[model samples]
Target: MPVIVVEVMPKPELLDPQGKAVAGALHRLGISDISGVRIGKRFEVTVDEVTDAVLAEVTKLADDMFSNSVIEDVVSISVHPAPASA
Candidate 1:
């Protein structure tokens, strides 16, 4: 099986309270390298194989179910080969 990785995140213009809170805490802890943080969600969907048609379908699914087209954006959709069988 192949796995499809879907990532959804708030639009850059959208307010991310959780990410801001985490970033503030990190800054208070002296983690200064991080300037900003945006919270997001990831999903791993397993499929029988990776093909163009399958990818197209997955895109549709991502647009329909995985992401909120109004407030969030679909960050990425990538296919990974399943782990080798022992």
Candidate 2:
């Protein structure tokens, strides 16, 4: 099995209201030292086989079908192979 990790975030030019809200809440909770807060999402996928080609395909799919390029950015796509039996 291979694991795929997808990280999605808003573009730097776009404003993230949800992120701002979370940051404000964190500040109210006495964590005021943090700044430049931005929110993002992560997705993990498990497949039988995942190669560079597969990652490219999936990235294209996500960019075209799932992510909105105007507001969202695909940060990274990482693939890790399963451990072999001893």
Candidate 3:
């Protein structure tokens, strides 16, 4: 099996509510210097192959199921080969 890693995040100009909330909590906890916190999603998928066609299909799935292109971005799409027998 192969593994696909997907990192999804908001565009630079988009607002991140979850990140803002965490930043606020950090500030209340005495970490007032923290700023520009952004939240994102990471997905690891196990598949039987890691070919261009497969990756393209997965990318489509990510666009449809995992992210909204209007305000979100995909940082990376990486495929790792499965580990060999021990």
TM-score of each: 0.89, 0.83, 0.84
Candidate lDDT values, in order = 0.93, 0.82, 0.87
Better of 1 and 2 by lDDT: 1
RMSD of each: 1.4, 2.0, 1.7
Residues 52-82 of candidate 2 have per-residue lDDT tens digits of 7788778887788667888899898888778
Clashes of each: 0, 0, 0
Best by TM-score: 1
Q: Rank the candidates by lDDT, best first.
A: 1, 3, 2
- Summarize candidate 1's per-residue lDDT along 1-86 as a digit string, tens digits: 78999999998898999999999999999999999888999999999989999999999999999998999999999989988991
User: 22-84 in candidate 3: lDDT tens per residue?
Assistant: 988898899967875889999998888888888999999888888889989888888878888
Point to the candidate with the largest lDDT: 1
| Comparing 2 and 3 on TM-score, the stronger one | 3
Task: For candidate 3, give the lDDT.
Answer: 0.87
lDDT of 1: 0.93
| lDDT value, residue 44 of candidate 2 | 81
Candidate 3 stretches with Cα past 4 Å from truth are none
User: Candidate 2: TM-score?
Assistant: 0.83
By TM-score: ranked, best first: 1, 3, 2
User: By summed lDDT, which 10 consecutive residues of candidate 1 come out lowest?
Assistant: 77-86
